[model samples]
Target: METVEDVTRMHLVGGNLALDFVNTRTGPPVGPSDDDVLTGYPELVAWGAYAGVLTTSEAAALRRLSRDDPDGADATLSRALRTRDHLDEIFRPLAAGGAPSTSALARLRDDEADALGHAQLEGGSTYAWVWRADRTLARPLRPVVHAAVQLLTAGALDRVKGCGGCRFLFVDESKNRSRRWCSMDDCGTAEKMRRYVAARRVRARR
Candidate 1:
């Protein structure tokens, strides 16, 4: 059974928080069979904790709220999914050297505004954005929204990349920016095995 209370089981290769959130969906990016790790509000909360965006206490409180208010929880989940899709629209196209849909960009801009409304700038020596009202179901997404905006503004757009072997998106933080595939352990290994098998089959046919 997929544990709704633990999202760390899912891959987190995106390097950027926003990209990791976008990577929650698996399989071909455009296909109907894409699997989503965030199935319910609990999983969303869990993912937040996994991503270090939410504290364990915050996640627990949200899970309790989900049990008390199912409808609202579902609505929040819908919002998360919508935000995720917008991110995919923006980053996925950028990864492919194309433009994102204007509408998606607009929506994500609005999302950033909403996120800012729920945040406060707090720091002693260095300032940092922090979320308030941990009880709110959308708390987890606040930081994610900021992360998306930060990534877009960071002048590192050239590093945003989609995995060659999977639908996962990641920031190619390699010193040479030559990294490909989501991870060497998963997609890279699988591709190598595929090539090896094809070579063996060709030799057998000869």
Candidate 2:
């Protein structure tokens, strides 16, 4: 059985948000939060190109190394980070206005479906099967596709776009449609308070 540490390490290596979805815990010895997992997804969701081809032994070794040594885990994470940069190039256009239609996205979808059929019939490699199961020829790209599709089809780019804290992406589905901060509990409140204090200071100076 894979321990929580083992799975977390694998997720860092795999560099996929889906691994976070499958994860059973969070941090500070916390159990998983479906909300936090969805919101605070650390995986860039763009790493399929590099993480898709590991042999089972390689995957297992990463898990083992992650469990045993910080150095090994850091090395694997560094590789994942480099791959994430590559994925950024591939996914940047999707978020920007050039994303294809759902049908076109569906084609990427269908290709993997077809591959899964072939894998089922042939049963060559479990890793290959896992790769195909993601419904993307590129495994970590789906979230970008999901967000892009939601944006384009709903035409919510201007309203839904922008992460206040950083370059992180998210769909702002606030009912008021005035959501300024990326998160109310975190950045929203803090930024608001900071602005308030700054305004007060300016008044005092005046």
Candidate 3:
């Protein structure tokens, strides 16, 4: 379990809002542990603010509302986790040049369908979705579902890559399109050290 400090220290390295949302959990690439950063409703709001999904004031407001209605907050947290799981199932296969499961796609479509009603055209050409300012804990998921749809429709699925160390998804927006790790300072460095040690052990055996 990550401490509050660890959660607050999370960075936005996923390059896309949806991918950043998917990266709340951290661990090994295979059989990753459930080390979720958003352990509670407040943490979820904080991460939303950190990921630019919500304004700081919006996060604060949501925090207060969660305190006022703990059951609603719990429901919201469950919905957010379900969204994350669906995204992981959908995007991981797409990133690997495979198709997403029908169930996952269906869930996403349902979420998008619900979210579409809350949107409004802003400044003639721009569109924006409005979340309820009151007890609707599921409001934050609107933008996430919107972002996932945008990424899928944009036909940039080839740019999506999974980290070699932690299996977190990220967009490989490099010039050469060769990004292989979540971060150079974190997974990249650790992978290099691992390879170096393996090579030294091989030499010792020789």
Highest TM-score model number: 1
| lDDT by residue (tens digit), candidate 2, 1-206 | 33333333433211223222222223321222222222111222212222344344444444454457656445544544433333333233343445434544555344345434434332545421333333322333333333233334555544433335433333446687665544566556777899999999999999
Order the candidates by lDDT, highest first — what do you get? 1, 3, 2
How do all the candidates rank in terms of TM-score, highest first?
1, 3, 2
lDDT of 1 by residue, 114-174 (tens): 8888888898999988995545878889999899989998748988888878899898989
Better of 2 and 3 by TM-score: 3
Q: Model 1 lDDT vs. the true structure? A: 0.87
For each candidate, what is the lDDT?
0.87, 0.39, 0.82
Clashing pairs in 1: none
Residue 79 C-alpha lDDT in model 2: 42
All-Cα superposition RMSD per candidate:
1.7, 11.9, 2.2
Model 3 residue 52 distance off true place after TM-score fit, in angstroms? 1.1
In the range 87-134, model 3's lDDT, one tens digit per residue, is 989988877879899999999999898877766545557755555442
